[model samples]
Target: MISNIAELIADRIGTMPASERRAAQTLIANYPMIGLKTVAEFSAAAGVSSPTILRFVSRLGFQNYPEFQSSLQDELAAQLQSPATRTLNPPSPGGGTVSPMLEATLDNMRETFRHLSDKQLADIAARLADRRGKTFLIGGRFTDPLARYMAAHLAVIQPNVFHLAGQESMWRDRLIDMGKRDVLVIFDIRRYQNSLVRFAEKAHQRGVQIVLFTDQWLSPIARFARHVIAGRTAVPSAWDSSAALFVVAETLIGAVTRQLEAEGAKRIREMESLR
Candidate 1:
């Protein structure tokens, strides 16, 4: 049985026909979220025909679309089942509706940290601490602010932190060097942009170490990422929550701060002195 339907789709997405590939990318990006939504809903969202989505599903080795959805739910049961959304929950003992939202945010942070190993965090911290290589950070429309904020935080304790938000000229200059021992940190969640994926692929081909902070749905960029931090984002709202994403940014700042030691401290002191 295919325990990882998302990974299976991701594995074969590159070779799928154009229309099928579009539908598959949407499915992979939303992951089990797509599982709860019907084929019609998914097709409309993917801008593809229902038959295209079905063929994409069948190609993934499922008997039918319903079977595929079932596999996705089974594969991602833990993530899909959020405590905040559970109907079995008693009314807040405090007798208020607001507590669940706050508690879910805390839970998001806890789950994010729980899955990330200390060693992995430390290694990524080490890469960020490198002064020999320039650090370039980028993210999609929704995630760009987080990337910018991380760059700001890194700059306080280190040199060579560059935040790249797309302006055609800026991207051209920033990406001029390949194989230059630079670190490219990307924050890519759902609705994954092909532009970012292509850039990441190109960077990887040029020996850039890509650090990716992404939703657990995972992206094609995962194949090229040197460091992949997958976090869960659950909220009661229509939009995807970025609370867990902030936890990761803060964690990276904390890790890199500690990893830099004397030099990092001295840089902070000097920066503060000027202020």
Candidate 2:
């Protein structure tokens, strides 16, 4: 059985027909929710025929529509799992004798990059490199460290990098200053936060382009995002892992730093002189 249906779709999406590709894109945007809908609803959302939807499912290696829906159902269940519930039934690949975290983390990184397109990475990096616009980063309860980490590197690489910390009220206060040229980088995973969603919605209204870093189950913030990186987060443990997302951040940090090499070097020297 395929461990992640989304990853399977990403791997096979290149060879899919145009109609089937639309179905795949639609499914990725809305995720398991659209897959759980009726065939007519799913097709309408994709702007494709019902047969095309079926063909897309088959390409994903499912026998029939119901089987495809069942897989999505299972994924949805796993996405909603709480830490308490996961501990009761942690995935044990080695019959509980050996830990599977290291292997899982490595696999997560491979699958994440395999699905991530070069064009998507480059487009986002270019946006961050543009010094005219401000960049703001935010995250959920557990993921905010990523926001701060990225913001720290970006602060040196370029100007106008802010990590939205503290309360939701504070985030909203900053929205008034945000406008079309600005970008919001959000890190939200499963059990997504409503406050962040609300903040993203407001940011989008002000014409701020969004970059979202989330798990396989795409966060609602994706609808407003200009770019979305759905990294693999699941592991054989009570809590979901952020290691893959961390690598993603580091990769972007390296990419953006390289893109702004000369300027970044001067900034580093200036920072040192100040110290």
Candidate 3:
């Protein structure tokens, strides 16, 4: 499967020169929107010269700047697609076919992990395993299950793990308890939730360490995030698949469980005794 520009950037970021790396990081933070701008605009935003920006585009396998911008434009369109729009105008005659759905979902999973590095996972896991700070998980309408799933696992492993649910006001009220020692894990995908973006911004201002799980286009929350895992959620169906994000959540749970093996096992044993 062809990797998106975001995925390509992630794959090559480590190998890029300092100037190119800066451009790549800037693009990842702003995502397709920044790439959609003129080359001069992109160069200015990345704090790199126009030639360096062109080189960065070339390194990503685009033949020219316009081609790079076009790819980003296509991704932007895909990112904004609604379920109703997809259903009304399917990508293919057999867009509803089970095989195509499964294939696309599996590809999404493949492409998601392709960009994720071991160091990134280990660092995030280590932070989550720490009992010195609180961990709070929240998600948008479609992705909340990921927040709940991770929270349920982490709660057993340690204390002060919270799954933030309920109204927007409720989420805001909980912010009072958050601070520098706290970590906020937010799961948000495309047609990105404005409420979550606002919540993330507020938490950022309050000094909360944020880990964001979003789709390739990235949620606006990326600006506030300390760690971000951009999964591939698009598929052949009307609804975007959360399968890849679910897998990513499971991977984190496994990593945290391993890190907290003794504590987690003891907690599990104690809970079993209570039962």
* Residue 270 lDDT, candidate 3, scale 0-100: 90
- Lowest summed lDDT over 10 consecutive residues: which window, candidate 1? 83-92
Task: Encode model 2's per-residue lDDT on 213-262: one tens digit a residue.
Answer: 99999999999999999999988888899889999999899889999999
Per residue, candidate 1 scores C-alpha lDDT tens digits across 1-275 of: 22366657767888889999988878767765875688899999899888988898888888998898777666567545775544323344664566767778888888988989989988899999887888889888788898999999998888888888767456646666746588999988887878889888888888889999888888789999999998777766566767798888898899888879889889888998999
- Candidate 3 has what TM-score? 0.65
TM-score of 2: 0.65
lDDT of 3 by residue, 84-113 (tens): 453312344544476688778989999999
Query: Looking at model 2, which ten-residue stretch has the lowest summed lDDT?
Result: 82-91
Root-mean-square deviation (CA) per prediction: 18.8, 19.9, 20.2
lDDT of 3 at 26: 92
The list of candidate 3 runs beyond 4 A from truth reads 1-96
What's the TM-score of every candidate structure? 0.63, 0.65, 0.65
Q: List where candidate 1 sits over 4 angstroms from the true fold.
A: 1-97, 178-180
Candidate 3 clashing pairs, residues 3+ apart or interchain: none
